[model samples]
Target: MLRHRRAACYRCLFEEPAEAPSCADAGVLGPVVGAIGGAAAGLALALVHGDRTVSGALLVFDDLRRGADPRIVRFAPRGGCPACAKAPILPSLSPSISPLAAPLRVTETS
Candidate 1:
């Protein structure tokens, strides 16, 4: 779920403002819940086919947007050490993170 929006935000960061994009295009909206939901609602004005999914997707989007970051934890990497890898990057987690780049931070969960 996060990876998807991370990709979308990456697109948002790199896309040219004048480059008109389709609904399928990533970051045509910000991929952030506010942006995506707003776009979906805007499209709903024209009553597009998938606006319904937008609300459902937005629920997940809102949840993720509010959190710090999603993580994947392995119970054991070696010697009972739980290795953790970065989830997709969202700029909200840290200003140091580039919207277009997901900088990996690997550490032991234990």
Candidate 2:
């Protein structure tokens, strides 16, 4: 896995006005959760689309309240990793349909 601490990437998404209230004051509307979720989804979509520039990556936003910068940490599975070895390979989907366009549905699974 590879990680990149790209300030540009963070700025592109979560750079708010200096005068804006801190996340603590915003409660559920904070950038902490939204930023993390968006970054994860974007990476997943890039992989699904066969983007050569992307690989297994992690974006970490540790303490936003303290004004800490986001960091990306990369790691690789050990040799002959059992989970990786057993992971199923699924057929790639054609890039015609946009996953973001679909409405989200939450259902209980047993």
Candidate 3:
């Protein structure tokens, strides 16, 4: 069995401030608004292809207040979670069975 380096990272996005507000009243559309904002941020990140230093970092957005500062939290992955378990090994394909396994040759052109 060959051991391979894992390139996968986990990231979570929060739509609200990290600290809870002092108000006792439960605001309406909080979850809906958060989901929409988070979705937009997630989509933007997915579509753009640059600097992934934020991978495995938590993004907290302050949608309720304009002046509030956004927050970012980074965490390390701990082994043992079934969802984050090691990926199952896949059977290798022979050259005749897999087109990608066939060799390719390149010729120089003047």
Candidate 4:
């Protein structure tokens, strides 16, 4: 769950006064509208799929969070990620088939 402090900070940093209204100012109607929209979307999904479980709800929540904020997608780094210098390179593509498809090299000296 997201904390109110972080949300407030994000609002202050990224949102404009005229364009972005504070959550506190939004009052009861804001939460109501959000709940209604979310429930409607979930109902639509359930109608289409005929199944809605805890995992499904979580997946929906994850999708919504990602859709709402792109920064959430990069929240955590993979354990064995070479680009971040945290792990060794693990190539998936063959060198002969696509020489140009190699990952961009970054020297530590620079």
Candidate 5:
């Protein structure tokens, strides 16, 4: 597996502070608001992209910092997920794991 710690470091170096996003809330209401906000955003994007499938509506926000601070935002790689160089996954008969997902191309985009 190839790691790009250097690229990530550079992304952080170029980042600037942006104003607080509109999602701020306090206490128990915070999670509820975030969830609803995510769902709404997904729905709105789905309409724009012309994809209504459940998978299409789902947005995977991988916060490497895991919500440590909202002011900091890392860059998403242009190539997206690194899928192509992965070794073949053995089919999982276990119900816990879903059957093999469609293969993803990991080739680096120029």
Candidate 6:
């Protein structure tokens, strides 16, 4: 079944290296690579299955990387909200805040 193939791929890509080196050996880079690969795989799988299920699977992979509960990444906010244009900052400031909050701060000499 397709599920078996996916599991095998994940094992080969991620779990196999556990014996050789912990994921931490590569710093955060390993997980980021794994996540990008997993997302691509999930998108390909979605072409075969329903989009909803593939998206859910991608969320699961992302959550696994972050050590948190899984949830879908909504591509668009409800009602085309402008505020949603900002990136989701998981553990840091929103990317847009710097320009909006203190545009002149960098030029001010201390």
Which has the greatest lDDT?
2
Which run of 10 residues does model 4 get worst, by summed lDDT?
1-10
| TM-scores of the models, in the order given | 0.17, 0.36, 0.39, 0.21, 0.22, 0.26
Best by TM-score: 3
Model 6 C-alpha lDDT per residue in residues 48-89, reported as the tens digit of each score: 675544322224445445766455433322332222323323
In order, candidate lDDTs are: 0.35, 0.44, 0.43, 0.35, 0.37, 0.39
lDDT of 2 by residue, 1-110 (tens): 23233212222222231344444454545565787678678876776776635454445666644677556554444343322334522213424322222233466879
What residue runs in model 6 are displaced by over 4 Å at the alpha carbon?
A: 1-27, 48-51, 54-76, 82-110
Number of backbone clashes in candidate 3: 0
Question: Which residue pairs in model 4 clash with each other?
Answer: none
Task: Please estimate how well model 2 matches the true structure, expressed as its whole-model Cα lDDT.
Answer: 0.44
Per-residue lDDT tens digits for candidate 5, residues 1-110, read 01132233221222322333232221335676687587667666765676533321223444575865233234433232222113322225333323322333355668
lDDT of 3 by residue, 32-79 (tens): 667757765764576365545455555566778775755656655545
TM-score (C-alpha) between model 5 and the true structure = 0.22
Point out the worst 10-residue segment of candidate 2 by lDDT.
6-15
Q: Model 1: which ten-residue window has the lowest total lDDT?
A: 75-84
Of 4 and 5, the candidate ahead on lDDT is 5
Candidate 4 residue spans exceeding 4 A from truth:
1-28, 51-110
lDDT of 4 by residue, 1-110 (tens): 12121122211222222333344444435665686578657766765575423211212233455446222211233333332233423334433222212244455763
TM-score-sorted candidate list, best first: 3, 2, 6, 5, 4, 1
lDDT of 1: 0.35
Q: For candidate 6, what is the lDDT?
A: 0.39
lDDT of 3 at 25: 34
Candidate 4 positional error at 14, Å: 43
